[model samples]
Target: MAIPGYDSGNVAEFALERAGARAEVVAGVVPDEFGLERSGRDPTATALADAVEFVGLEELRAVDAFRIELVYDPSALPPGASPTDVGIAVETDDGWERLESTVDLEATTVSATLGGRPSGSTIVAIYDGTGES
Candidate 1:
């Protein structure tokens, strides 16, 4: 939902899109620093931090024969014209860690690649929420 050219109200709307890549975006958390402020008039103002991180992942596995393709519309989900960092959790026999790769956000979609993720059984998840990105 969080398209490069769009900025909604929620940070989860942001997605990590790539090509020829297999992976899932997990734990996406955008901690916007919110603080109370006092001015000459209104004493109820808050500051927000503009940062991006993984909050959730569709989930993937080479053992479960699981693969998916993420294709959804990022229409006004996270209304912003900036690219966000995508984090992922790769499931393996040795527990899990952070997945390192490139996630490019196109004009209409997002894609990702995870260590040359399994072919054929590719899984793609697109933003399908009616909210803004």
Candidate 2:
């Protein structure tokens, strides 16, 4: 599925595999700035783009896994932050959880394969000078 950006002209694509039931997915980009708090583990973590929301994911049951890919503009990143420093984060009950994701520098995209279906908001995050890139 291709999710169009609300105003940034960016697009996010996702794929659900091994879903137990049919899903009624509605996805869109939240063009507003997202203020992500700094964590002890990643004090320099910052939001690189607007939030992406995936609604109706609750309709999917017993899904094995899903993959999401977000495209972002390079200009949106802070100075000295490369695309390699970018990762995917999902809003959880506790807080925003960063997912293990891979960055395609050539495509300006970051992707992650999440185990099971996640019903919440997601965003592109960058950990400045963390060397995770």
RMSD of each: 17.1, 11.2
Highest TM-score, which number? Answer: 2
TM-score attained by model 2: 0.59
lDDT of 2 by residue, 7-110 (tens): 32332233322211111222343222321222323222466655555544555545444566666567877777666877777677676777777777887667
Please identify model 2 stretches exceeding 4 Å from their true place.
1-45, 125-129
User: How far is 130's C-alpha from truth in model 1 (Å)?
Assistant: 22
User: lDDT of each structure?
Assistant: 0.28, 0.51
In model 1, where do residues sit more than 4 Å from their true spots? 1-69, 81-104, 116-133
Q: Give the Cα error of residue 116 in candidate 1, in Å.
A: 5.7
Lowest summed lDDT across 10 adjacent residues in model 2 is found at 17-26
